[model samples]
Target: MTEQLPLERLAYWLEKRPDAVWLTQPVNGRWHDFTWRQVDEQARRMASALQALGCQPGERVALLAKNCAEWFIADLAIMLAGLVSVPLYPLQSAESIAYVLRHSQCKAIFLGKLDQPEAFAAGIPPEVIRIALPYPTLAAQHDWASLLAAHAPLQVGHRQTPDELLSILYTSGTTGQPKGVMLSPRAFAFAASRSVVEMQISERDQYFSYLPLSHAAERFLVQMSSLYSAGRVAFVESLETFASDLKHVRPTVFFSVPRLWTRFQQGVLEQLPQARLQRLLRIPLLGRLVAKQVRKGLGLDRARILISGAAAIPRGLLDWYQGIGLTLCEGYGMTENFAYGTFNRPGQVCFGSVGRPMPENQVRIATSGEILFRSPCLMLGYYLEPEKTSQTLVDGWLHTGDKGEIDAAGYLRITGRVKDIFKTSKGKYVAPAPIEGEIAKNLWVEQVCLMGSNLDQPLALIELSPVAREQAPARVADDLEQTRQQLNAQLQPHERISHFVLVREAWTVDNGCMTPTMKIRRNVLEARFVDELAKLDAAQPLHWQ
Candidate 1:
C-alpha cells in the first residue's frame, strides 16, 4: 500500500527494517552507517529538544547545511514534531540568508559547516535559537550536542495530516528575489513515489547525496526517495572530494546537474588523445574494453541510472554519453511542481526530449505555447504571495513558464524559458538556450551565453576548455572563424550569432556568474558583458586574441 507521506513512510520502514542502514556518512576516512531504528531514535530526540525549546507545532525551523546525516535528522525531527522544515542552500549569501530567515519567520535554525558563520551570526537575530551541527571551530553559541544530551525524546503524539505543510523551499532566485514555495506532506510524498516508480528505484539502490538538499530536485529525489524506498543515502564530505567519495560508494543510482555531467564527460575525453581515441572507439572489441575501463574509473560501473535535471542537458552531450554506453536521462520540472513533471523512462529514453509525463500528471501546451501541467505533486502556492500564486495556478493547471512543444509520441521538448525569448530589431523572436545548448556540445566550449536583446542578430559569449585554449592559441582566430561559420550554418539567419567573444575566465558560483547548481545567471552575465558585446558588434571580425 502507498504511504501517506515521508514521515509515515519512515515510521513504516522503522517497523519493517529497523536494523537496515538508512544513512551513511564518510567521516575521517571511514564510512559511518545509521540504521532505520537509529534514525527514528535520533529524530525523536531532536524533536523533543525543539519542543523543550518552546517550538510549537506548525512553527518553522530552518536547516542551513550541506548534505549530512545531521541534516536528515533535523528534517525528520521537524516533521516528527509536527513543525515545518525550511531548507536554506548552504552557499547562499548573507543577505539571501537574512531575507529568507526574516521572511519565513523561522523560530529555530540548525547550522551546518559554513565557510563564514560570522555572516550567519550577523544576519540572524540573537533571540532566535541557533543549533550548530557538529563542526570544528564553532563560535560560542547553541551547540547541537548539548541540546541532544539535555533533552529527552518527547512522545510524538502531535500527528500531522497528509495535507499539512511539510517544507518551505525557497527558490534559487535566478530570475528574481527568492520566494518560499510551500509544499504539503502529500505533495512531496506523491512526487517521491512517482519518481521511484518512473525511475524504477528499489530498496537495494544506493544513492550518493552531493547536491544541495535545499534544492527541491535533490531534496525530493534523494532525501524523500530514500525515506519512501528504505534505500541508503551516502553523504559526501565535501564538493572537492566527490569523485573520490563516489569511488568508495559505487552508488547504484546517481543524480547530477548538467554542469557536473559536462565535467565528467570532459574528464573521460581528456584521458585519450583525439585521433587515437577515435580509432580505438571505432573498433568494436577494443571499444568495449575501453568503455568498461572508463565506466570503472568514473565509479559508474554500478550506476543503474544516471539522471540529469534542474537545467537543460545539451542534446549533443546526452548523445555522446549514450554512445559511450551510459544511458543519461534528462528530465524537466520546476520548484512549483515539487521538482518533477516529465522524465525520460529508462528503456524509452529520447535524446532531446524530456520524455513522457509521469503517471498522474497531465501536461498540455497553452494557446500562447507555454507548457501547462496538472499533477497530484503540484505545490499548494507560494507562501503568503496570493497574487503570484493565483497567477501561476489557474483553472487547476500550473503555468510552467517554459516554452515547449509536445511531440506526437508525447515527448516534451523545452525550447526556452518564456521570459528568455528575445525579439530582435526585425521583430523575429529568438530562443537563445537551444542555440547555446547546440554550441556547448563542442568539446572546446565549456559554457555559452547567447544575447541579442535589441540587436539585429544573436551574439555569443563563450568560455573555452583549458585544453582548447592551450593547443589552439596559434590558430585561435582561424578556429573561431570556422566554428562561427559552422554554427551559423546550422541556425536560421536571424538566430545566428553575428559576433562571438571568448571569455577567458571560467564562470563559477563563487564568482557570481553561475548559481550554486551551476546554472548561468543570464541577466548577470548579460549585464557584465554589455559593453564588450557592443564593441564586438561594431568591430569587423571580433578577435579576442
Candidate 2:
C-alpha cells in the first residue's frame, strides 16, 4: 500500500468516494466545501493549464502560499503535470526567496495569499512565469480562474513512478543558505501511509492545517496524510479567523510548532492565572469540568492526537497540557526524512523524549552522539549539492546533525545540535538546548537563548512574554532572579548562568531572528547580540535591555 503514489491515492478516493468532501476552505468569511470530484477536476484543469503555459515534464514549478485548498490542489496539479513541486514559505525574505527560485530553476510559480506581497514580489525573477491563485495576490501573468476556465481537464495526466522525483523542499536553516531536500513520490507515500497507520488515522479523521504547507511536517501530516488516509482537511483563512475556524472544524488531528504552543499557553494563562488554574485542577469533579471547558475553549475538544514538533518544547508546557487532559505528543524529524523519525504514540508517551522510532525506521546514535536515521521515506539527497549530500547521507544512513540519546525503552531525547554546543573559557562544554528548555518553564520567558562561547559562564538572553512585559520591572526581575537561581542549582559550576538579559524586541520571522517554521536562528541571534553581551558585567545577575 505504501508503494502507491499520492496521486494514485487521490485517484482512488476520486473513484471510490467522489462525493465525499475532502477540503473545506474559508473565503471572504464564508466556508467553501470541495468534494473529491471537485478537487480532482480542479487539479486536472490546472495540470493542463501548466502544460498550456509551456511547462515541460520534469521541470520545477513553485507554489507560494499558506495552507489552503488551492495549495493542496496546486501540489497535485504539479505532480499530474509531471513537474516537481518547489514550495516557498510565504514569510521568507526576498534574498532567501530569490536564492531558492534561482537555485531550483522553477519554470513557473503559483501565488496565493501573502501578507507582505511587496517584499516577496522583489524576489521573483522576470523569466519565471507567475500564475496567481483564485485569491487577492501579487500581479501574475496568468490567473487561476481564467486558466481553469480555458483549459479542459487533463485526461492523460502524467503517471508517476515510485522513484520519480516529487518535490524539492528547502530546509529553513538557522545558519547559511537553505538547502533543498530532494524527495521522491515513494518517500511521501511511504511516510504518509505509515504515519496514518501508526496514528490510527482513517477516512473519518479530520486535519486542521494552518501552518505553512511548504514545510515537510505540514506537507506530510496534513496534505499527504489526508490523501493516503482519505481523510478530510480544513484550512484556516487568516490569523484573525483562526480561532473561530478551528472551533468550527474541531479536527481529529492537530499539529503545531513549539512557539505557537507556548503562545497558546500564554493566552490561557492570561485569562486564568496559572496559580488559580492549578488550584482548580487539584479538585476532583471541578478539575475534569474545567479541563473539558479549557479544551473546548481552545478548539481542541475533539482532537484525538495533538502533536508538537519543529523545535524543542519545554517539558513543563507538555505537563501543563496533560493537566488539562490533553496529551500533547512530541515528534522528531527533519525535511530530509519526510518528518517520520519518531513519534510519541497516544497511550505510550514519554515526556522529555521524542518517543520511539516508527516501525521500519532505524535509528541509532553515532560515536560522536549525532542521531543517525535510515528510513524508507528518507530523501534521495540534497538537490544539486553532492558534497553536502555526501556528508549528510553516508553509508545508507542519514546523519542527523542533532545530538540525542536513546533510553532503555527506545525513546529518543534530543540533547542539542552538534554545532550548537559551546565551550566556556574554562574549556567546559555546555549543551544550551536543555538549559533553554529549563529556562522556558519560567512564565516570564517567551523566548530564551543561552550562549557563553569564550565567557567564564553562560548568559541567558530572554524575550519577555506579554504578561511579563506588563508586570512591574521589580516584580519581573524578582521572578527571573528566582528562576535563574533555581536553574543554576541544577547545573554544573561552569554551566551556571552568569546573568540574564531581557531583550526589548521579540524574535520574529519578519525581523529574521526566527525561521518561517518558528525555530530560532541561533547564529543570527548570537551575532546580533555580540556587542550587547560584551557590555554586560559578569557580576550582575540580571540586566534589562
Candidate 3:
C-alpha cells in the first residue's frame, strides 16, 4: 500500500524499523544521523510544544528554512499538531515573504538558515512567535533545544483527514505577485501514492536533499517522497561543500533543475575541454572506462534514477549525460498538480520527452493547445482566490498555462508557457524557450534569453561561460558568430536571432534577474534588453564579431 499521511508513514517506520537510519545532516565536515525512533520522538515533542502554545487545529504555521533534516521534522511536527504548513522560500525578497506571512495569517513561524535573513527579518511581526531550527537567527524567540525540552511528547492519536488542509504553497511568481495554493491532505496522499506506483520509490532508496523544499517539486518529490517511502535523506551543508556532500551520501536517487545540470556539464568541460572529453568518450573500450570515471567524479555513479525538471533542459546536455550512461528522465508538472503529471520512467526513457501520464492521471490537449490534466493530486484550490481558482480549475480540469503536445508514444513535450509566447513586428509568434534551449546547448554559453517583442525579429541575449570569457574577446566573438549562424540556419526568418549581445552582468536572484528557484525572469531580461533590441538592425546582423 502507498504511504499517504506523512506522520502515519513515519510512525510505521518508527515501529517497524525503530533503529533504521532515516535522516543525515552535515555539520562542520561531520555527518549526523537520525534514527526512525529518534525522529518520531523529536517530532512528537515538537507537536506537543505547538499544541501547548494553544495553537488550534488547522492554524497556519510558517516554516522558513533551507533543505535540512529539521525542515522535514518541523513539517511533520506542524502536521501532527493538526496545523497547516506554510513554506517560505529562503531566498525570497523581504516584501514577498512579508506578504505571504500576512496573507497566510500564520500565528507562528520556525526559522532556519537563510542567505538573506535581514531581507525578510522585518516581515515577521512582534506577536508572531518564532522558533529557531538548528541555525538560530536574531528573529528567533526560542531555539530548537529549548522547545524540545519545554514540552512532553505529543500523542497524536488520529491522522489528518483527506479533506484537511496540508499546506499553503505559494507560487514562485514569474509573472506577478505570488498567490498561495491550498493543497489538501488528499492531494499529497495521491501524489505520494502515485509516485510509489509510477516511479517504484521504495524504502531502500537513498535521497540527497539539496533544493529548497519551498518549491513544490522538492517538497513533494524529495522530502515527502522520502517520508512516504521510508528512504534515507542527506542534506547539503552549503554550495561550497555540495561536491563532498554528494560523494559522502552517494545517493541512489537524484533530482536537479535544468540550470544546475547545465552548471555540472560546464564544470566537467572546465576540467577537460569539451572536444577532448567527447573524443575520449568515443574511444571504444576506453570510452566505457572514461564514462564510468566521469560518473564517479560527478558523484552519480550509484544513482539508479536522475530526474530533471522545473524548466526545459537543453536536449544536447541531456543527450551528453545519456551518452555517458546517466539517462536523465525529464519530469513535468506544476505546483497546481503536485509535480505528478508526467515523468519519463526508468528503462523506458523517452529522449527529449517528459514521458507518459502517470497512472490514474488523465492528460489531454485543450482546444487552445494547452496541456490539461485532472488528477487526485490536483490542488484543492488557490487559497482565498475562488474566482481565480474557478478560472484555472475549470470543470475539475486544471488548465495548465503550459503549451505542450502528446507524441505517438504518449510522451509529453513541453514547448513553453502560454504567456511566454512573444510576437515580433512581423506578427509571427516566437516561442523563445525552444530557441533558448538551442543556444544554451553550446558549451560556451552559460545563459541565453531569446528576445523579440515587437521587434522585426528575435535576438539572442547570451552570457558566455567563465572559460569563454577568459578567452580573448576576438575568439569569444568568433565562436558566438559561428553559434549564431548555426542556429539561424535551422530557424525561419522571423525566429532567427538578429544579433548576440554579450551581457556584462550576471543574472541572479539578488539582482532580480532570477527567481529563488534559479528560473530566469524573462520580463526582467526583456526590460534590460528593450533599449538594445530597439537599436538593432532590421535584418539578421552578419557581424556578431
Highest TM-score: give the candidate number.
2
Candidate 1 per-residue lDDT, tens place, 245-305, comes to 9988888988999888878877777787656766877899999898777788888989888
Off by over 4 Å in 2: none
RMSD of each: 1.8, 1.0, 1.9
Model 3, span 101-162: residue lDDT tens:
98899989999988757777787877787898987454676789998998888875337787
Q: Which ranking of candidates, highest lDDT first?
A: 2, 3, 1
- Global lDDT of each model? 0.83, 0.92, 0.85
In the predicted model 3, the residue pairs found to clash are none
lDDT score, candidate 2, position 452: 92
lDDT of 2: 0.92
Task: Judging by lDDT, tell me the better candidate of 1 and 2.
Answer: 2
| TM-score to native of every candidate shown | 0.96, 0.99, 0.96
Greater-lDDT candidate between 2 and 3: 2
The 10 consecutive residues of candidate 1 with the worst lDDT sum are: 536-545
Model 2 residue 398 lDDT score: 96
lDDT of 2 by residue, 363-398 (tens): 999999999999888899999999999999999999
